[model samples]
Target: MKKITIGICSIGSGVGQSVVDSCKFFREKVSLIGLGNNPLAYGAFDCDKYAIIPSYYDDQYIIEIEKIIKKHEIQILIPGHDDEALLLAKNHEKLTNIGVKVLSSPYELVLICRHKSTYAENFHEAANYFVKTYKAIDIKDEFFPLIAKPEQGFASKGIEIITTRDDLEKIEFEPGYIYQEIAVPRGQDPSYNAFIKQLRKGNNLQVSEISLQLLFDRNSDLVEHCATYNTLKGGVPIEIQPYTTTELSGFIKAITSSLKRLKAFGPINIQGRITDHGFKAFEINPRFTGITGLRAKLGFNEVEFCIFTLIYSIKIKKLKLSNKYLGIRQVASKKVLQSRVISIKKEDSVQKNILLTGSTGMIGSYLLKQLSDQGHSVSRLYTQEKELIDNKKGYSITDLKSGKINLSNFDTIVHLGFARPNSTDSEIHSSIVNSFELATQAAQSAVDQFIFISSQSVYGFTSNGKFTEDCKTNPQNNYARAKVTVEDHIKSITKLSNETRFTVLRLASVIAPFDSNLSHEAYSSMIVSLLKNKTITLSTPNRLISKIDFHDAVDAIDHFTNYSSSSVYEVVNIAPNKNFSLLETMKTVAQELGKTEDMILTESIENEEPNNLVISAEKAEQQYDWKSKTSLNKTAKYFKKHLGY
Candidate 1:
């Protein structure tokens, strides 16, 4: 069977959410389209497709609804609010002409139900069950302890309880107010009396209430009815149970007969409280109520029955009701990360907001300074509590993972934090997991560009010649394996996002001997040995190594931050134009430090195969128009100047 396309309006309201929830059961038989005035409506997020339209009171509301219905090819439209229901009922012919069926009662019936005075005057069959109501202008002093309600309102808004003459005199007589007798008599029920006594003592308590839901077919024949006794907390039903008594059954039978006489169709909800005078209805809603979805849990779904009978022309003989469980309502929450609205600006706009992780580390520290010097707004991310650097505030990684941090304000995120090779197994594991989590959050938050500082060690120590970014990874150590894991995870997670661009930079060994913040084992070991001992030994002196200047690595990252492309995921190797042997690199450093060649010695270990590490940066050069400019000799000179040897 072809799925019915149904559209629901006013999705920001409680009834709208309930209708959406009820429709979920027949998802295979229908396609749902949610329409809301607010952008963050919960029901909007739950639908297959949704659109924001004008308010029901707006002049363009009907036109917008028509457009949306035609766009989505909607065959049925359900009104979610009383006012919306009345408006749609008034334009029944206009909507029907466009091949759409509106699930609503007649306009006259809706208007009578909306106005309390009108309902009391027209609903003669249920006169004994309805509380005596009067116009606000005709209320007298004898009508003390009466409840004043808005003539046209739902959800119990604008209700005032006038218990004394003084209370009545002090209230302003609004134009659209109706006065009705309170359902609970002054001293009749002990439960109501006790509740009143506690309320007088400044303690609020829940009120016992009941609701009778009636469903009718297109021909005004009563199809099903459900009676529920519930408790209200702050005008909302918190606990409810299927309830029926000898007296209540009689009341329902009379009301159903009266509604059928009046040609009532679709869903109708009557709300009241049981008093000594019997069940007194204070209000009647001519459409679905907020508990409609809750009713589905008991297998008495009025929505499904109405759709099948009215829209599909299929008769529903009976509804299967469940009394095995009670329905409890609680507060539920959903997190919605709206897409960031970026202002239109020139391409060369300065002052980009950047978030930097591992801000105190070697590459991060240098990158932070460079970005700040370029007039970019930079925020540092710290794993633990630390002192402020340059009076800049630090954000916690915990906050990012927990969604406490709003990443929409940032244009770029540079993640350089990682555990060193010497770290414990647990620490390394934590770092790897945190890195993936950060990437996932970044993608979900819709950050513009996410640059992950990966290591070329992911290629391992097996390649003897130069390798490009397309080479397969062969990790030889736990650290290299962790880097590959992060790379793969970032690519997979970011592929789902259209707003975030993920760039993975696999950097070669970075040489920054002049900076004390450097802690990598390879460069640190070589420098420490050359400075402390007159003779330095190398096991694999001829082993080739690919290294990039610290400034060049930082520059490469800056290049990608400003780069834009159609590709959402990218991986680029960052290395120098030339590769050198370990012996040649140490010799250059010794020469720069004014040491003779005799100070450096080479030794070969027996039965050991030489392994070389080399990577090509042709992708970065071709795509980013960038290359490593600083040579090894220039880096060595900086070391000599700092060491004063």
Candidate 2:
């Protein structure tokens, strides 16, 4: 099936975001193009393609939209703001002429709905339920404790409550402002009074605010309607539940009649309170509301129904709604990085001054050589005076501990120094102390970035499912515990500083061909057993393990050090996409060395199941575009050549 291309305007507004959320339900059938005046609009990152266009008030707004429509071959355009909707409604002919359907009401009806006083006057069937509106100049003492609002606004902006004549005299009256009786009268109902009192005290409590949505077909006949009792904070619904009342049913019928009289079609939203006299409507929006997405989750998907009915001419007979669950809302964020204009053709394309610890360690030695060869200025941090004698750019660990090293001189810090897995308690404690001090100083100096190399053992090596970065840490040993402690400390110290970015790369077991300086303990031991004994044995042959190539580990460090643009703070796993069991790995080694499978042996335990230590590198791929390129079979070949097998 061909996907329908849809365009959304005012992508930063709540309504625009709601429409974007609704489109996800039909993602396989539709393509979204987000349009906004600001490039940094939140919806820009959510859509398939985004374009910055002129504001709705601009003369070139329609022309720009038309160009985008022709370029992307858009079939439908949905307006996200009230003012923008009205503008689109006025230019409905221009859009429809270009083979695009504008999802909005007629221009005449939108005008009445956009203006507060006009809406109140035109909806005569619900006239008795409309809040009494008074002009600022015509206000009297009897209208005390009235709510003043802008004649044209959304999200409760420019609104105030006037409790006394003195309060009214203190402010200047604007031309486009209207005063109305408070929707909820004081002392009317205990629950309503309590809600208002808490609101006055600025408490975040769930209070009732009823909203109704009416869907109309192409013929301007109301076909379906639903209502939600909502609780709002900062003009956004935080919680919603299905609600119905005798007064609400009558109000919906009356408003349906009013909408038919005014020839309003498509989606219309009505908001008000259940007051002493019944349901009084204070606001009417001619387009979808923020809760439209929430309604879709509850199975009352008006957006889908309207599109099928208006565009495809499909008739939807029954309105299905599920009220068994409550809807809750929370804020979500997405990071947008500035695009890089310069192509990184070589490792030296973008140079950064780096301060590196653990210069003699397995991964650190390779990383140090790579950084220096790439033309980056590298300064090594040594734990002993003897290690610093030959290098002029080297500083002792005492220099770091005593504040003798000026950390601000370096743009980035990579800490890979740690005690070995079998180290004593005191040695591990000392190592942790040094790392904490370094992180504290780095944050204090406002370094641009800090990269810490941790281990996958922090996940506790469970036997079950694969572990993503979000899995809870269950450090089972001293080494894993120390890593978690240091990770927490680094995150805490860097939390308040926006200038410093801290990244924790939880690395899996590293494997490579045998080399005195480069070989890791596990890989070296395996190679030695295979060469000397001409056979290998495993107690738990089915145990799954995660390993990365040595060169790939070095590349990951380099990528995060310079190329990652928007990672303020993150913790991601560094592992290969493939998984291999202990027995399979040994067999691959034997095959590379011209040995048969009979040379491999396993002692299976009676009831012991094999444990898994598989790590997920999905976040690294998605966030930094980093992945392992070297295969395990290739590493086995390298081992064959290194050992002369």
Candidate 3:
């Protein structure tokens, strides 16, 4: 594959280090050239090849940048700061002609986004139903302590509140600025006049965005995080504050309908004032505000979203993250806030918002039994409809691209369809994406839990001895990658307190009475070879194979009821204890089936020092009150009836 060249630019202050770092994590073999002085000092850039240019207006800006770009034949340029983005937008076409790509929208769009005054003015006119009147009050108005900000410029640069004429004189008066009426509070609490804004442009309200900006007469200081101490009095700077669950669905639905009309090109932050009439629009931040960072974690990733929109004009619903799923974010802080806690107010019902793939598969069929037994209603996605019985069960292999859903009126989606290595790549990708896409669509149905049946294919071999859920994974092939993709998407979308859970059962090689790998089901392969006096090779001498019976797998699925919000159970190796050798395993089955040794060939492939996995299911047992009760030998007895040995 050809190497992708990149130029990284940060604005003057408080660059988007996190966004840049995240980009760097995915883009390898990137020729990363930096634009800005002291960028290295911030310790954000860690590219394979890099150079630094001075300030945006510095003489060396063109000289140094061009040199690095030409040297590396740079193709894509991603800005880390708003100011750098502004400059690049103006010269966007010029850069494009010079074989450089600016990942931003047009100049006019950039202006519309950057100008804070324009947002307030435009929203004042546009926000008739959702927002109240937005007036650009005079900077020198008689209004005591007016909230004021420059119409344009970067993040938190020239923001202040005007309490007196003296405070106004300290700041320079500029055109296209807003002097808004400050919200007064009756109580002494800081969040007394707390407000949440839902930007409504002609009725299409996409989201009810709430930002808690601190007020000190004359836009004192822009605190990045905590908007206020007594957040009830003012507003909390927390991203996507947990709204009352009762009002959430209706509120979000209203916002979604409102924003569909106001087609916008860039980031928009609307100030909401719920007056005597209704939600009155106060101000609008035209550009991608810091709130973009907050809302993105709700699974939207707006930074990523804007990049695509700016380049391709594609409007992506930020990857549909949920606050309903349990989320615990631990940040290093000197101020010790109260420790995080998850206390569910309402009792979560079983099988609400359910999407269960492999609904027809062996383990899936068994899981269906337990789910039904527990009074949980489930929706299934089956691979094939073989018999008359499947008709009543809603057998479906729906088309994912067209979004033709089978049964998405579900609350929990249990995905079990994954293409194996024997299947082609497209087939594998299709099955994985289909399973997830089905679940993703089901999550749209207010589903709370997304349970996927993933194999322990991720742990190709556990060499550092025994493995736990926390052990690092080293997937050797496509199967592990597919499972990881689904898991990642689930976590990103599932929110805290949605009662939405993402549980993966990283089962061991499961063998039932019907499995192809069953010790008895396909013994003919080794039996024929043994009858021909062929030497049987066993490479994993003195090594262990993690094993699980079908019943044990079903038990694990039943255990998701008491799922933890904090723990992301990625790999629940649903394996039984005791790793028997190929010879020992065959013998165990043979004695039960009353088969002779002549029917089996114990191939010893010699000591390759095989790497095997044995996971600690301590958490599963402790938290879910679950334990594997069936032994491999006992389960193998079912082969007597099913397998024609």
Candidate 4:
């Protein structure tokens, strides 16, 4: 059977992530793609593959998404945010023509459900149950100690309680602001004191808050209603338990039935309180609530059933409730980084399933060895899963041109591989940029850290005395330009994840064993001249050069892997403190090879180039407590042995 590809936007949001998680119910039959603005968003990492798009508000947002859909062949495109849902719904026709279904309610109904005030006016059955709503101008007959919130807001933003006439005086009433009678908590409840405390913290005070999620068919007929007793923190449900109330359920059906003409096609959430009179629904969201994951664990799994039914064109089945009452409680976590090398808390650290890319390259080979020597459980991400010794641990790009790839089950992502596109112009952007973006998408997953091996070439050809992390980048060549692109992309992705750290090390040219493919200019010249007894010409023998041994590069990586700090992002220049002139460097290598005068050098010419193009490693030395331990002489000797000189 052909895979049914589904793509979801805002995948980092709790609501969006729940939708992605639901696809796991279908296993291999479902190929999930996550799209979002932030690279560090947890949802970006959770999907089978993902792409980055502009912010939903950006004009290009839909355009970019449309491109992703056509490229990935996505059959269904699900928007996870309320505003995004509206955006997609508004563009449903255009997208549908391209063979993509916007898995959301009709645009008209989405408008009705999005604006809270509109829902009450349209559904009279639940109007009386709604708290009396009034604009500031309608305050003539309204009472004090009322609640005020955005008329069309989601997630309880801009909510305030007016306890006195004086409090009301301070508010500059806006058109979208709605005022209503405050819902007080019941004194009889066991947690009444806690509720009062929470209310004092400026939260909406209510005796009982409930979430009624109703799934509607494409024709707008109600298919299923799942209710949950909710405990909220920061407007997000932290604890939830399945509940059944006949009166509330019937009332919800009546409310939704009134909107038959809306023709909503997916999930609708009603958030309100049960009061002395009856059930009062103050707000309604036209999309999945943030507690969707909690509800799934309790057996509803609306996201799964909804997507499955829509994709298969099957009739919606009555939801089966768990025989035993199910409940879920969420815990929060925070990340902290510090100066100097520090051990990560065992509980906080992802010490298992470390993911490594660029394993086939020079530094990657040594890194693999170092990780193994330290007894780490490591996995390799390969371009081809078949090339991996353990295919289960590998991640592969579905399509490079489209930047589609699934990423999961890793603690950290070390990105070292880069596409060396031969083209030095815009023509190479697609392939080169796609590699970085795909890696970023992979890092957005649950990985705690993303380490990218950047190059000092990003600084281009700086004529300054020395460079630092603060140096302004002026990319000169296509390779350097690509590196800068990756750096910026990585920064954007990691910004979304406060708990994850992104480290970019701008390394000096590396001196490694002679391999035409991997060796830098200086190392290659030294090896070729010594082995073939050929002359090594220099424009100016007095010109100074700074190079790091391959081993030092490995050591620097080890420092980063072990160092823990409070910062979520850091960039450091990796270079030796000392510099070597061309003549001195050539003599050192020749002496190490015991070649002496056998390795010839052409006469030097007058040149105006600076003696040094090195960067300062002060920050690396102070913060990471590490620096180059090998001298240029030692590097030459090590290379001589490795090169079989």
Q: Which number leads on lDDT? A: 2
Indicate the residue-level lDDT of 386 in model 1.
Answer: 51
Better of 2 and 3 by TM-score: 2
Candidate 2, residue 60: how far the Cα is off, in Å: 1.5
Q: What stretches of model 1 exceed 4 Å from their correct place?
A: 136-142, 185-191, 198-206, 315-318, 340-645
Local distance difference test, each candidate: 0.77, 0.78, 0.50, 0.69
Clashing pairs in 1: none
Relative to the true structure, candidate 4 has a C-alpha RMSD (angstroms) of 18.0
TM-score of 4: 0.53
Q: How does model 1 fare in lDDT?
A: 0.77
Residue 322 C-alpha lDDT in model 1: 76
TM-score between candidate 2 and the true structure: 0.53
Would you list the rank order by lDDT, best first?
2, 1, 4, 3
Cα lDDT for residue 105, candidate 4:
79
TM-score of each: 0.53, 0.53, 0.46, 0.53
lDDT of 3: 0.50
Query: Which runs in model 3 stand beyond 4 Å of their true positions?
Result: 1-354, 383-408, 495-499, 515-541, 561-571, 591-606
What TM-score does candidate 3 reach?
Answer: 0.46
> Across residues 313-341, which tens digit of lDDT does each residue of candidate 2 receive?
87654555577988888887643333321
lDDT of 4 by residue, 132-184 (tens): 77666667534766788887787777888776666676663465777777655
Clashes of each: 0, 0, 57, 9
Residue 248's lDDT in candidate 4: 88
